[model samples]
Target: MKHALLGASKAAQWINCPPSARLQESVPEDPSEYAEEGTVAHALAEIKLRRRLTLCDSKQRKALDAEYEKIKTNPFYGPEMEQAVQEYVELVEIRVMAAKARSSDAVVLLEEHLDYSDWVEEGFGTGDVVLIADGVLEVIDLKYGKGVPVSAYNNPQPRLYGLGAWAGYNYLYSIDEVYMTIIQPRLDSVSTDIMPIADLLEWAESVVKPAAVLAFAGEGDYCAGDHCRWCKVKGNCRARADENMKALAYEFKDPALMDLEEIGSILFITEQLKVWAKDVEDYASGQAMKGNPIPQWKLVEGRSNRSISDKDAAIAALRATELGTDKFLKPEELLGIGELEKRLGKKEFAALLGTWIVKPPGKPTLAPETDTRPAMNSVENDFANTDMED
Candidate 1:
């Protein structure tokens, strides 16, 4: 279990690490079999959609058969491929129906690698779907994550894919506007957003360039926290050591012992530690700036509060339910000390109270014992009498 956890951590690390760093650190393992499965599912969906658009008799079964044949020999496909293929076929059918109902055109690109640059220095990605209808292009990406639906807005990967699609189709034919969509069949939802060419270029310049630089330099810092629990190098990272020490100290030590004096001392030292850590991080950043190959580190925050527009409506609806307001008793409505005594009788209530009010564990109450003065030794008097006798 430990080894598996470690392997998973390394996999996650590799994903965020820059390509150059990945090349340096042997060949980072490809994403898990599940990721491959998702790709197969996406590929099948694209193939099915393409057949439906091109063929006059585009029966669902025919499309499914073609998809199955395409994936049969692939080493990536496993036992779960059958189920994934079934889901993909159903999703494609649903999408086709929706497009037909809306009187919209749907086109799919099968294994189409859209290259933006002639030299292909950096700009290129395979687009799964490039839908052209009503004089607008919609780039749709398929995701298989069961969590929250993937959003295309502000997502670099999808945007890059969109750029590739734009370059490919525009160079071939012509396009005025482009819309990006991320469809998560597992979640049964599609998130759509739009980006202008100019905006996308700006994103590439401002975001992608910097990320690429850091990744190329292999200067990503060791960010140790809750995330370190899943980091590949957690066992060896100094930051992890510091974190573990702090955690253990907090857990075992008495809270009362962490008085103002101790807290103040820690706070003072913490500032110094922060400065030193930042200095190291800045050194790495400098190396990245110098074009030294390094892994990439992105600053990601914890989950933020979600905005709920219908909060009041939700509360009102909950109150209307049988297991809501009627089932809950107000805190103030509960019996008080005096009332309890009256109901249960003084003796019973006293006994209950004795059990209820818990006493804390006793503390050491030892006092110092002292002697007022030293006593003369009996041996000295015995020696004086013995000398007289001699």
Candidate 2:
């Protein structure tokens, strides 16, 4: 399926930074194996749900074999992949049962195609599963990626799905409440946000509609923030560069002269500046790999560790030389403390090893006073404590 220019997955980015929608048009999307795997996972989940609901048409049934075969071609398809899809399917089944129990007339929609073009031009998306009851509508979205823990609270993608679902089923059902659920089984996270229809529509009119208009028209400023994570133009976004540059251009002043507010603002921008710097470096490296060299920069072989050309052959040669096993092999060591903690489970590990655990004081670092972690004791305080101990 083709992705819309302003897809729901990117709603957070374009909604906040409207110009990004048009800016991304010129930059081609970077293809990733991860994305391919995610698509396969979604397809498998859709197949499972459709089979359970028996919602597929004859044409869809005919295409199922090809779709299943296509999934097999994906390197990511395996027992683990099937297990994860099964977990998501089970959750959807539970939701479906609950919704039907509330109202026998309730309907469950699988991979439902929805259009919200009335609110935003060309705005449409597919909902993984949508449940509509007498006065409630639920949109359940499965997130296959575990890099970011997605939450439904104030999440734009799921909310947009909810909006699309309500638009499609509003005439049939009196949906007073809309529920958006994100199932991220890899992270063991299931987040749901309940929104009143009145509030969602109000927000759409006030914030989303206005932004969508500007974005579609290509007439808005590019404001950079966390939302730039997946924007196609992020590699060379001038607005992002300008924002990061401003952080670097801060004038030097005496530490005593800086006010608390000024220091706090600097701290906030510094972390963003660090991330932007890394993004720039990574983008340049990727371009360099395609024979587009950055000025005064060229790739060089990175440091590598030594390894046997063929482990078995090397072992055979060592044995032929009459080398003892003890001479050729290293002694096994206990697993790392972190690995043990994970294996034993958090509570069990903590209970068993609590007495042995000692967290050394972290090195003093600068941060905004507003940071939640308590400030490290002052040098004077540390010395005072030492003196008292003496």
Candidate 3:
């Protein structure tokens, strides 16, 4: 049976550590502001290019700048940066078209979602641009993020996108091979990679299908770790602590004792812990919802005693004295506790201590308890004696 699995990036991690699935599953909706900003930028870029291509004059360029000025005050990004990026993208598109980079006789498919069933049980993806350039199918994805620059080389997402494009075009046009490319307009870099249809299909069949089956089974085979910091079910997992401890131990162990077999075993156990941790986290979350006590702990906020920076006060006090010139304590120098205690008298120092309040750590549980056990023997005897007197 085919089930909706985590995307390519997450699926790759799952092969190494199943606990990472929690992160993949708990992805929240994109921030509205970010979505709006992206839309505005893309729309502006498209408009500018279409205008430049149609008008083909310096006058049109000035008009484009004026249009950009209207939205200059927008908080998403400064107008200058936005305009620069738009211009860069326009230039790249022009260059690619000028060189006839795409095949003259190649089929063109733009902004289409393609599905491939030949590889995995039910594989589907979409490409930003697809064209049969030089008689070979090419799939391209445009990325905006600078933090993680999209690389076409050994990139699974783009490869999957290529597969989808290949599947889509192969039906209508006889395609022999597929090529993938990622253009980062912001970085002014273009990366290209090739994937053979046979290899791509093999990965889907041998790797992706089995992983999808395991994920869909809903078995207690997931684990938790630092990745749980972003997991939705972290609060429910008891195995989180165990997994965290195990990960720590593995990290701290001596490298000298690790053989190939030992390393393999460690990897396997780590994956298992990830699954178990997720299960525990899920179970605990359910318990909490039912008003049951879930075994969990948090760092107790405790106050540590610290000396106040009384440099100004000390300087002022010393300056007030008519000692030859108004020579005061240097701002750079600090008095030790012992020196301060000796200078201020024991009684005065004790009085100063009273001015400081030490806040102790609060007790853990905030819930009120219902008394279910029998009264203490002393309390029972007192109640009995009071009843006799009455």
Candidate 4:
């Protein structure tokens, strides 16, 4: 799909740093396998959604099945994608059922083009599922990636989608409220944020519109923060580099002299600073590859490992050296539980190997408070005193 210049999905970045939208305009987009996989996943989800929600005739069913078979042939598609997309479709079905309960005449729409051009300069986004009822309009988006668990609460993208949804459908329905939901089946995440139509409109007027005006014109101050993660210019953005560099401007005291509070603040800064370092490195490497070498640095082959080019011939020569089969090959081992589960599926694998498998405690690791997992019990909770369950 061709995205708008002020696309809703990138609202967070442009809203915060209005100038970034145009700054990234000329930088080519990097092809991502994860994104390709997500596209395939959404295609599968849509087919299932149409089949289950719409009353399909026999011919329609065959068509949908054929569509699904074609999707299965994609390299990124598999049983895992099939199951994840099916779960996402089921979640949408549940929401549709609830919408129908609210209004018997409720209408469900799939892949609807929602335009919020009133608040933004040609801003638009696709709502994966839109349910229009008497008093409410719901926009549900399917997040096919499992990278970062997405929440709809006060989230800019879905809120923009909500704005767009209400904009497109307000005349048809007496919508006083909008519900924006993001379903990430692979990550087992479902989040919904409810906003009254008036409040949503107010946000658009106050927060989104002003920033969008500047963004569309490619004017406004450059700012940087977490939203830089997906920016095409993140690797070379001076604003981001300056922001991360400010962490080093902190006056250093002896580690023993710095209080815990101060140390904790530094931890937060270093986390983002690390990502900045990697981005700079990657961008520089790419430049060097294109013969635009960075100052004082040139590309050089680093390392290699030798391996047999003809495994069969090598094995034949090895056998001629009086090495018997028993000497050459090791005993076969069962596949790991994760691989088995992927191959045989969850229920079947569980039924066959449930008794034989036991999960030990997972190693403890530092994570942000926003992680949904329960906190370790505090016997000092210094993390050293806790055992984490898988």
Candidate 5:
């Protein structure tokens, strides 16, 4: 009953691992707080943008306001969440303005449902923001996740959204170029990829359509890559295991014995192996919990930390018994410098405490030459030179 495996958000995964679309059906789609938080953030962004544009009807405005209020009441709502949504709103506003500037007749569409069934079978998705001008179309997506920095270059999600937007608006607008932008405000990453209308359509027809057909029919390769991270079947995926195990076949006794490419291959395989091992462990644990224990394996209680069940009452009782507060709880102390900086704005805190600050050179460490940090002086040579100078 699990659906949305072929959703635009997951186009990259199914397009690459075609079999994953069907395989995902067997696994339960576990709810994620991060996802829920993102939903709330998106709702907030929609409300703010709609209000700014004065595009909302009275009823729609009231409903959105209610939804916004309800979401703000969630425990996850905080200053950071508000700020991130605001950042997305500002970026959309800027892009909309830029689009209109190019041509007075330019139109900005919000949360528009786009049908891409022209190339993909019954394919459709909503573009967060779509800007159509004289000869250009811009599809803007707001990515609420901060864990990974998403890029628009060859990124399937934005591309799919772009295609959907184009399919819906191409008839009205003489759109020659398509611009896809992924705005990840949390990570401060905004990446855009521009493609000609002809090329974008060609790629969709040649690449996406075929892949989607195979994926929907549960017939295609299970090519594994970074896209496998969020796949439901990843833990028990045989193809993933087989692919990772290919590294073990290489019997290089030591890393130094391998060439540049071999070493790189080993490194990539090692990382995949780590993921595979973790997946196996999680799958086993889950099975055991469901009374379907693995051979010679049984679930055991994990170590737990002690806690004060009734801290306030216990503390009161202790105080009544003439026990000092220090016996149970430490005296209140001033916040650490780091905490103070957070309490006061960073700039104000720095200005106040700047004179007292001292920064020591960090210890030398090994890193690839491509690292942005400057390499430290050689320890032995630096000490020797210091001694001679002294």
Candidate 6:
């Protein structure tokens, strides 16, 4: 799909950075397998949703089925994806039914184009699902990846989509509020946030419009933060390098021991350091590949290991050896809880072996207080452990 320079998907980035949208256009990103898998999952979810909602006529249904069959032929498509997408479809269906209850002419549109150009110049994006009723306009985005948990509260992406939805449908319905949602089936998360129409427009004018004007004209200061993770030019951006250098200066703070404030500061930029270091390495490698090597750096073969050319043939030869198959084979092991769940599915797995399943406490780790997970009580845990021992 063709994307506008100021797309809703990257609203969080450009709105925050203000200068990254045009900077990103210079360095094109290579497509990954994960993105392809997400596309397939979205297609599957859309098909199931259209069928359940009876949004398709007979001819359209047949075409949709054909497209679904074609998607099944892809290596990424599987029952696990189907189950996850089914959950998404059912969730959407529930909302659609609710919308119907309130408004007989409720609209449920999938993969619909949205125009937020009023606030952002030529800014548009595709919404995964859009629900329009008399009072509320809802925009739901499907995130197939499980790497990061996305929230709807004050999230710029869905908010922009909500703006576009409201702009396109306000005449058809008396929309008073906007409902923004994000559904990450892989993470089993459904985040919803409500904002009044007045508030939504207020944000658009005060925040989105000013930043978008700067972004579209490529005339703003370069700011670096979490949003830089999505910027294509991050590896070589001088602003990011300068920020990282400034952030790294804290390392010079007492080497012997650290105070809580110093430790917190270090922790804040730890991930940023790692991401910057890796991106610089990749950038250097790409430059070297193009015969633009660094002055003192030279490329050489990195460490590698040999592997069997044909695993099946190698295994057969190993089995014929006098050393016996024991040398090559290990004892069979049971699948992990997650793998088993995938094979049996959540419902069936729970029904058959829910009693046997147990969840152990995860190792304690440091995180920002903004994290929604409850903080671990180390003192209470130790007391409980002592009591149990006695």
Instruction: Please give, for residues 1-390, the per-residue lDDT of candidate 3 as tens digits.
Output: 122344443444443345445444654432456457655655555445545433446787777677667656566555334644564456546544732555545454444566654553345555556666554667766665444456788776776677767766666766666677777664667887876667766766776566555554433256554345434455454456666566646553566677776676676666656766576756665566667765573233459887658877866776677764325433476566555544554446557864663567554432212434443445578899999999
Q: In candidate 1, what are the lDDT values of residues 113-161, reduced to their tens digit?
A: 7664421234466666666544456666677655444567666566666
Best by lDDT: 6
lDDT of model 1 at position 118: 28
Q: Which stretches in model 2 have alpha-carbon errors above 4 Å?
A: 53-74, 78-80, 251-265, 330-390
Q: Candidate 4 local accuracy as lDDT?
A: 0.87
Give the alpha carbon lDDT tens digit for every residue of 46-159 in model 2. Answer: 988877766677898878867777786777786556767878899999999999899998899888887877778899999999999879999999998878878999998988
- The candidate 3 region of ten consecutive residues with least summed lDDT is 364-373
Candidate 6: C-alpha lDDT? 0.88
Better of 2 and 6 by TM-score: 6
Provide the TM-score for each candidate, comma-separated.
Answer: 0.45, 0.80, 0.49, 0.91, 0.85, 0.90
**Model 1, runs deviating above 4 Å:** 1-25, 56-108, 116-120, 147-149, 172-176, 217-390
Clash-forming residue pairs, model 6: none
Candidate lDDT scores, in order, read 0.55, 0.85, 0.57, 0.87, 0.83, 0.88
User: 120, model 5: CA deviation in Å?
Assistant: 1.5
Model 5 alpha-carbon drift over 4 Å, by segment: 1-5, 57-60, 253-265, 333-390
Ranking by lDDT: 6, 4, 2, 5, 3, 1
Name the regions of candidate 4 deviating beyond 4 angstroms: 253-257, 345-357, 368-390
Candidate 6 per-residue lDDT, tens place, 1-390, comes to 788999887888899888889888867766889889999999898888888886568899999899899988989887678778888888888888988998998998888899999999999999999999879899999998888788899899999999999989898888999999899987899999999999999999999999999999998988888888777787889999999999877645556778788778788788789999998888889889889988899999999999878999988888787886678987799898888877776777788899999889899998898977999888789899999999
Q: How many backbone clashes does candidate 2 have?
A: 0
Q: What C-alpha lDDT, on a 0 to 100 scale, does residue 54 get in candidate 1?
A: 51
Q: Cα-based RMSD of the predictions, in order?
A: 26.0, 5.1, 22.0, 3.6, 4.0, 2.8
